[model samples]
Target: IMAVPGPSLFTLRDTSQKVVRYHHNRLVASPQTANAPPGGLQISVVPNQFMDPSHFPIIMGINGGTRCLSCGTSAQPTLMLEVSTHHWGVRPRAF
Candidate 1:
């Protein structure tokens, strides 16, 4: 099996330079092959705290594979974020 680069851990800090939360991130490979009908890669981000229940563990799709056009091994991953007012508050909120 090829050695794929896994996910990395990240944190978020407030204006005061205080770490407000952290992300326990991971990449899950599906049972099927990467070149299947649809992409079999998924990215999950579980926050340490101050997350809405509905969005606590955020899961998103990823284009899976190890092949590259110019480079031999393209092992980089991408993450997209969509921030909104509902994601922040004076206190943590529940779903």
Candidate 2:
């Protein structure tokens, strides 16, 4: 898991938000193969005030990217946010 340096109140003399705008969590997409399905990627981002159970905090975004917030709340945990992107298309036959 690749982590990006984010803003953290903890950095500011023992506070919270110990990972703001930092983690751009992403997953390496695999190369396409014959008759193979599409691949996907991952990302992370900061958490906004609004909370959506449909998309849990661990993955609070669309099917492509997520933003991790260094700023944490009593409700949200200060963990690295995550997301994924899926690419769909026809699989080519042998060359």
Candidate 3:
């Protein structure tokens, strides 16, 4: 049984994009740190507007700038990962 091809799982564009990293919920398989551009940690596999509305919405991390929450209290397979390491930079502090 060796047939690996259902989109080969996914990791980039097709998967939209992501930078998963975790510690409390469990799911940080090798995330030392290097968010690429504006920093890292992303995870997307979307589409479910009010219980599926036609389609078009799978934005995981969109570059860490989108967490439109309404009420709160709902963690399922709960995996909306995003990370930052390499000493977690922010170059600006000499005090």
Candidate 4:
């Protein structure tokens, strides 16, 4: 999984190399991947909310090739976010 952060929210690229997004309380494939398959793949949904703010390292998202929010203990979490790219037709904000 690869995550590219934006202004407020971020876009998730799944193993299928398709962008994934959270909408209406569920995780769905984003139609942003060029020359990709239809509907991408059905990914297991996870709560798209932040953990305890006190967590030593909590990765909310990454911005402009910089670590926006710090996270930790993700050795093998059910869902993972990772990647780098400027999407939505806007340049990423400098950290």
Candidate number achieving the greatest lDDT relative to the actual structure: 4
* Residue pairs in clash, model 1: none
Q: Is candidate 1 or candidate 3 better by TM-score?
A: 1
* Candidate 1, number of clashes: 0
Residue 82 displacement in candidate 4 (angstroms): 20
Which tens-of-lDDT digit does each residue in 1-95 have in candidate 3?
12223211223322334444434655434433464443233444343232223323232432233442111123333323223222555422212
Model 4 steric clash pairs = 2-82, 3-82, 57-71, 58-70, 58-71, 59-71
Residue 93 CA error for candidate 1 (Å)? Answer: 2.2
Candidate 2 residue-wise lDDT, 1-95, digit = tens: 32436422221111332222222554233344554433222233443323443433332332333233222334654544322222234321112
Clashes of each: 0, 15, 9, 6
Each prediction's TM-score versus the true structure? 0.21, 0.18, 0.20, 0.30
Query: Across residues 1-95, which tens digit of lDDT does each residue of candidate 1 receive?
Result: 12225533333334554432212443323333344434222323323233344433333222332211111112454334433234555543222
Deviation from native of the Cα of residue 3 in model 4, angstroms: 22
TM-score for candidate 1, please give it. Answer: 0.21
Per-residue lDDT, model 2, residue 19, is 20
Please tell me which predicted candidate would have the highest TM-score against the true structure. Answer: 4
Model 4 spans > 4 angstroms off = 1-10, 33-56, 61-71, 78-95
RMSD of each: 18.6, 17.8, 17.3, 13.6
Error of 2 at 1 (Å): 30
State the weakest 10-residue window (summed lDDT) of model 2: 8-17
What tens digits encode model 4's per-residue C-alpha lDDT throughout 5-64?
Answer: 533444457676657554564556666656655443333222223333232323454323
Q: Rate the local accuracy (lDDT) of all candidates.
A: 0.32, 0.32, 0.32, 0.42
lDDT of candidate 3 at residue 46, scale 0 to 100? 40
What's the residue-level lDDT of 72 in candidate 2? 30
